[model samples]
Target: MTEITPRIPPLPRAEWTDDAREVFAYWGEPNAWEEGSKTNILMTMGNHPDLGKVYNIWGKHLLMSNTLSTRHLEILILRVAWLVKSAYEWHNHVGYGLNAGLTLEEIGAIRDFPAGDDWNEQDEAVLRSVDELKNDGVISDATWAILGQYFDMRQKMDLVFSIGHYVMTSWAISSFGVGIEGGADQIGFDLRTASGKIPGKTYKPGEVEDWTDTRGY
Candidate 1:
């Protein structure tokens, strides 16, 4: 897809200050890799400099190690990305989703999963929970029952925050025009114009129409 590239600062990793270098070292990265994580590292470490010192490492650790598997994390992330119509996020994370065993059908169906007969029980629950959370800032009891059956209390807690955190990230990408820097493939989600046949129209922030009480964490 043709996209208007957003103007952002080039990464400044080589000219790091002593403090930034210390932060980088604390994260256990003395070197950089060319593929996969370069853009994220550069964005989180070098570009987003004003953020919290260990924001990069700590945020990734929360998703990678704590809340859930990379598979489930990618699920919520891709869904949120699609909701926001973030071509950058959808392109970047689809490969990660595939590597984590999410099928092309699964990835494609996330945009309006409520109408699609494409997801399993667990996948549906996860997607629906994220769907409600993003649109309404809460998960309904029906969806929670589905998630609670599979995830323990800790996993469930982290799962909640993980979805919210990713919504924060996707919102930043869409609103702040944080352009994706690497090889970006287009998933071409048309969020603005509803086809009138799928799950629903685009999800806009601050327009969540409903709310439901969720469990702790």
Candidate 2:
């Protein structure tokens, strides 16, 4: 994994104010501010408690109440993490993905969809939609038709919103340089070591036109 010095280091527990504590409380038992807590993303959000609180509300919905199946949700999340190359997001979701029932080979196959025989028709459509959204900012008609065959209107909406949410999340995680939590379970494939088959341009910080070979499929 690429080492990133946090541009906005996680706010220490001692510095957490009442608002921050309340925001952290949303995660339930063993409050995030308590000792031994390893939710670095929430800790980083502590820098802006108001944002944390609201963001948590939206995130909570996606994680806890979304109409999409756990398998599909994790698939979307892992794909976005791979597309954006957010190691922190990727690492955390790898555990979530596994727990949600995706096998290691299936998780690894997310790096390049349709290249392996791990996915079914619906699963393949979901993967393709993620790539389409990433590259074109829209899901193509063909992909939408495939999705319509299996997902309801609500599920489709959740699917798109979930992708957009994770994309935004990956941006924040990368920009904030949130590192993997301490003692995090060693599960899931690391983006640094995963092989990617897709082609896309790589942009350096602050250099719009000066890009190198395609990276982060």
- Highest TM-score, which number? 2
Error of 2 at 52 (Å): 0.5
TM-score of each: 0.70, 0.82
lDDT for each candidate structure: 0.61, 0.74
lDDT of 2 at 83: 89
Query: Once model 1 is optimally superposed onto the true structure by TM-score, how far is the C-alpha of residue 54 displaced, in angstroms?
Result: 3.0
Off by over 4 Å in 2: 33-37, 185-217
Model 2 lDDT tens row, 1-217: 4456888987776787888876766666243446423466777888899999999899888877889998899999999988888777777676567667777677788866667556888999999999999999999999999999999999999999999999999999888988765543323344333234221122321223322111121
Clashes of each: 0, 0
Candidate 1: tens digits of C-alpha lDDT, residues 86-154: 776676566567666777667767776777656788888888888899789899999899888988998
